[model samples]
Target: MNKPEAASIGLVKRARALAPLLAEEADEIERTRRLTPKVVSALIKNGLYKSLLPKNIGGFESPPMVFMEMLEEIAKADASTAWCVGQCSVVGMTAAYLDADVAHQVFGKPDDIAAWGAIAHAVQAVPGGYTITARWDFASGMRQANWLGAHVQVLEADGTTRMRPNGTPEIRTILFPASSATTHDMWNVIGLCGTGTDSYSVENLFIPDSHAALRDDFSALREKGPLYGITTYSMFGLGFGAVSLGVARATLDAAIDLARKKHSVGIAAMKDNSAVQGLIGRTEAKLRAARAYHFSTAANAWQEILNTGKLSEQGRAAIRLSATYTIHQSAEVVETAYHMAGATAVFKSNPFERRFRDMHTIAQQIQARDNHFEDVGKMILTNSVIPRGPTM
Candidate 1:
């Protein structure tokens, strides 16, 4: 892959520098079920939120690998913050598909962040644009966002569901101010509590035509950059996969630290135990291998985009495979670390418990599901083209 620009390197450094603050605020973030204003302010101050925005529109449009590395670094400090950043960063990519004037109007501001979730209700396409009265769930990072988006199936004036050329229902993501929607406090969960992954409702909200964009549609893309060539969902897979790796890395490091200082009742110090040493060595190898697989896949796919100006079918499949595999592998490493930490892993005060919970939650997300392997396997078996879109 090509070298990342200076701005991209700066962003990664800023992410790393924010780690101590994120670690300090992790508990508060979880208690409040949202990022603190200070934390959000720091993120905005660092310009970390615009990691994937087009540079032409006062955005970074950072290299994909650089974006992944930044998220991984942040995830090491706080998975929820990293998760929220991942969600918002990818959501911001919608700017690439919107008209230049409209995109600038929506995302030109420094603090403009958007978050949306599972497509639920159909939106009526009006003469001017569309009117939506729908409720979406699992909108992460909405608590701190200035804008919210709804991915809905477009219904024509005749009350028919609009169809795309490929026979699927036409879906467009409509962006609107967060103030226009009623946010629900429904983010009760055991892990990644700081993400504030909650449900929200917008009633009879009128979205102008300029606010809607066909996400991940290459033909509809307005930006001309290799980064825009990749789909948003692919970026999510890469990012959240990195987040899982960060959680795994932190968990393992904690375990290693504990081993050196911790002692059992009847046995020697964990660090002195040959078995423990061997386990550490093996888990380290496992994590390194997973990280290698993940980054190498991303780098290869990025090189493809740089060379061909688009991500190929195989590139997408390989990314899905590597990302999903890395997430699962990372979870395994976290499990090993948590297990090695033994009873100490259960306490909230210690690092192992939250990371254990966060790792499992990451595995539960759509990007880490087992079915992704099946999808890629089918493609490999038939050598047939898979349907391309944000969801695929």
Candidate 2:
């Protein structure tokens, strides 16, 4: 895919400038067990929070690559901010797959701020629409969000759950009023503490016929634009993968600083060890590879959209795999940096430890690097199709 013109060099400068502020708020966010309103407001005002928002709605509507670059910077400063914003941006992209009317209602509001979660455990059926009931876990960004998309399995009119072509129950993702759901203050986790990825329960919440959109049938969407191209879904992998990469980058940088000054009992300085130097070189190489792969894949699919106005299924899968590869490897790179940081990484207050914790959480993400590998394998080896479910 052809690469779009590079983002203005000025964005890199701006992202660098915001790093200190993000770092300063790390402690406060941890103390509250959620990102404070102050941090959210600051990020939004700085344009960092909506990096992936559509251009029509006063956003940069940046390419997936640009957003990925920014995420690395944000994670270097604070993994929580990267995590929160990445989650929000992807929800905005999902808006493209919905009916045009639904998309309009979602982004239609001047103050619309969206978040998404999947209630895979909750399933119920109604006449025209469906009833969703369950506690969505790890619904990041819900604290500051105005709306959320919850994934559900559809139940048919005959009281039987709808089934996919594979005969597994077919599922749908429904957009729900964020306020209609009640949040439970149950987000007590060691990593990603500030994400407020709490348990939120919606009891018998009835969604109208319009708000439900089946991801598997994105073509049925009435909203047709360059954004509808499969590359848009690449943002899911692009944005979050960058977050992990950023955390890993920060961990390495911090470790290098610590290594330069410390003198072990037997060694004159940690940096003097050839092994440590080799690890640093390895970390740099992995980071560069992640950046290249991410941009190349986003460029591939987006270039097709700009030229032909559409991307085929094969192209979409490649971008998805690219995202997964970049993010998953990024975790390994960061863990390498952590190992070089020595035993000090075990302390909770240490930035190295926090980054390690945050990077490890990437494995738990719904679109995890491991799952992406599995999906790609399925696509290649058999007549098997991409698993269509509430969650992509």
Candidate 3:
């Protein structure tokens, strides 16, 4: 196998090796509403956070399939950890688009971590760079990051919004030291709380031009690797969909275990019941189907990039379809497993409750939204999606 292939296998092994520790720390993570320092340190030590970073930056830069598999393995132990890893790893992909000096400054160290949130505010243009007083929310894994990024619309010095050549508002992701911002405790949620997906704000912080990049723009690409050809957005979808599958697999397995050991007073043993058997069979089938489709889509997309050095519009649509469909299907499998566990599923001591909540939470994220189906369907129907060069 090639060096990349070998590196991919090694990373997945590392992730699997860390699973038991994640499972052990799961409760503490939930209680603290963030990953325990032990878990964070372990992940850092393993270099799992740099899974999607460019190889030139001392990262593994593993294939999309390997990325998904590693996240899935971690998710089987702790979905929040998987979510945080998935988010931060994809954020690292931005390094490929940035200037080499700036990229190294931001993500150079072994333990360096960077986190960012959705686009919300605009940064004011200046001669050297941009100045921004803005707050960004939903920054997952922010607690441990030493660097932070903000995706913002560009406001020109003359009080006009900068526009891309395509006529859309110009957006740039500005990277700054995490110490420059005020971190907030805003990640209170029903599930995936261990991610520490908090909010933060910076007041008139000046970011040099070198510290920013037009994310996912073809023209802005600085690192020309086949892995960089895939869009960050699609990588997020693929990774999170894998997380859902892991959660579903674990939940279903727990349900199966409960069925084997628990028996009601009146009804027959759950494992012996024909109905329970059928449900287990069907749920397993569905979970496997979803996983298969998810991996196949990712593999096909990666293969396309390798063959043609670009991802086609059809490939992008296929990715969206597979990710959304797998997320929804995994949720169904989790629901079925939770229901099968009966009273046991409701108890916090059992695995079902948390996994159930986590599964639903994954289902509700932007990656799993039902509208993705409509979007991809529209694209497929039109056949007018101009095949762009490798771009988001």
Model 2 spans with C-alpha error above 4 angstroms: 1-14, 97-105, 108-111, 119-130, 162-171, 231-233, 369-371, 378-392
Q: Which residue pairs does candidate 2 place in steric collision?
A: 1-300
Q: What's each prediction's TM-score?
A: 0.96, 0.83, 0.96
Q: What are the Cα lDDT values of the candidates?
A: 0.90, 0.71, 0.89
Off by over 4 Å in 1: 1-4, 384-392
The 10-residue segment of model 1 with minimum total lDDT is 383-392
Residue-level lDDT of model 2, residues 1-392, one tens digit each, is: 23222432334456777788778888898778787777787666666655554555444556666677777787889888778878886777656666656776786544566776655754566777777777777788888788877777876667677887778776676788788888888878768888887767788888887887776455554545566555435667767877877787778788888888888887768888898888788778888887777677777777777787676676677767876777678788778878877788888677788777777777577656467677778887876443221222
Alpha-carbon RMSD, candidate 2: 5.2
Sort every candidate by lDDT, greatest first. 1, 3, 2
Best by lDDT: 1
lDDT of 3: 0.89
lDDT of 3 at 264: 87
- Residues 316-365 of candidate 3: C-alpha lDDT, one tens digit per residue: 87888889999999999999998888887899998999998988888888
